[model samples]
Target chain A: MHELSLITAMMDLILKDAQSRGIRKITRVELKVGEFSGAYPHALREAFAVASRATPMEEAELVIEEVPAELRCRECGAVFRPSETGWACPSCRSQNVLLQGGLELEIQSYHGRDGDVGQGRSRQGYSSGEQEES
Target chain B: MSVKVVVGKDILAVNRKRAEDLRARFKQMGIKVVNMLSSPGAGKTSILEATIPRLQKVRAAVIEGDVATTRDAERLSHLGIPLVQITTLGACHLDASMVWKALEEMDLSRVDLLFIENVGNLVCPASFDLGENLRVVVLSVAEGTDKPAKYPAAFLSSQVVLINKMDLVPYTDFDLERVLGEVRAMKPDMKTFTMSCRTGEGIDRWAEWLEKWVRESQ
Candidate 1:
């Protein structure tokens, strides 16, 4: 899927930002993807795992928050999320509406920790098997 | 302690910037690029095969993007036109960088109309812009009539929607009018064309539209 490409772009930006802040390794990445953005969360998760290998972002927890697709009625200017029937605005029931904010793909934030030479191999003692909680 | 940095940047920002640069270059060179998206077996390549010859007035070039095959490039190369092919290896869609590289391989001095045939994907390709002047999504009648409803993003982003394989419409249970109505609802001012590559029914109309844009761009 193109999620590989999407994740690649995200990782590039994240790594750049992380590097600028002197982050040697990343612990987690929080991303908000809109439903209408055409990036499925499930597929993106799988892509993230494969794409982050052998990098400073290896084994990082990827927290994805999905944004619901919203629409603005062209005829009535009423903004609402589409129901089961379709993308028709709930207020005016107009099918001819513009999508407002369902197509978002952005990184809200990320957590990174500096590499410690003193910790060395001891860092793998306990937390190696456990995920560091926020 | 781990630092949690609040970085609110669009993941596609890099691609968008590159796309804007390509757009400026195209504008400077007076080149018109059309990005075509479609699902597999939707007659995109066939439509291109049909339409290219008809637009004799404009010097048209094609950039074919496929997941893993040079067959599309080979097919278009037979026309003796300047065609560059980008194989994404396994990627689902083509991005601005890919098109920018493809453009480097071609001589744009005499080229006025450039067609970027995107990978056969209705979903991911809609999100990536190849810096085309116009975006057209092709749908074949055999694919079913509710396609526009199922894939709203493609219709929303496209300025033109082409319904291909019209010759097979009578055989399939495709409701042409209903499909058109749904397409209109998504994009009221979208330019639409109904054509069949096999029958050559409306190729001239499409070619004429391309000619008009090519001239206007110049």
Candidate 2:
């Protein structure tokens, strides 16, 4: 499935960020996956474990946030959450609503050890890359 | 061990970027490009065979992508249009790099419409953008009606869905209504047309759409 390839891409991005910031370990990697993004979260989790082995994210916790599908009504310009049945604008009852978001598959943050401060700034502390714990 | 974290997002982002570049190039040349995606045996080739004759005045070109065999390319070549075959050598989809290569080798200076027939796989091709303005997906009635639900990625990504092989609907127990419903459920606004490329019924509607697209693009 395409999820295997997506997992590899995610890992590559993680590795680049860690190397650039000089972060020693990644305790958690927070991600937001949209409901209509065509990505299976369970399959991605399993694939992430295998692909991240031996990397700094090996012991990293993956926090997957499932973003519901949303649509912005073309008529009223109101944003509404899409239900499982269909996408409809709640404000104006318009079917001409364009997609507004929720298809996000982004690595919001990575937490573990904070990287060294740059540009002679004070240390940002452990919360620098802090992800939402719960 | 410092964890260098990067978020590449979709694995096909680079491919998409390349496709966009190709799109810009096509626009500069004033060409109407259509990216065709579908499952195997959806009569994609047959649709092409039926379409080329209708577009004789438009001067179209085709770029065929497949894992192996030049059969599709050969068939398109027989139609007397410039055709190039890009063999992925086992890859499930055609990426932008392959299309770039095909564009370089083909004499498309006079070509008004470029039809890029992608490798016949419902899953992977949806993720990759081939730099075409319009994406057409063909679904044969011989396949189950549940295909749209099962393969939402392709249907959702496509602008038009051609329900092919309508002639077989009578002989088989395929539910045309359910299939159309499923497709509409996934993409509520997608333009769909039911046709038999074999019998040449409803080919004119598809051709008219293509012609309108070309005229508008120009």
Best prediction by TM-score: 1
Model 1, docking class: acceptable
Report the lDDT tens digits of candidate 2 across residue range B137-186: 99998896777756656877899999999999888889987777666655
Off by over 4 Å in 2: A17-19, A22-28, A42-63, A66-103, A111-134, B1-12, B185-188
TM-score of each: 0.90, 0.77
Off by over 4 Å in 1: A83-86, A115-134
lDDT of 1 by residue, A1-134 (tens): 67988999999988876665556899889999988788999999999999999999997999999998877888999988755445666776677888787788998888888744134452343321222324
Which lDDT tens digits does candidate 1 get at residues B29-94?
988999999999898889889988888789889999999998988878777788999999988899
Model 2: per-residue Cα lDDT over A79-111, one tens digit each: 777664455566666666666675566766666
DockQ of 1: 0.33
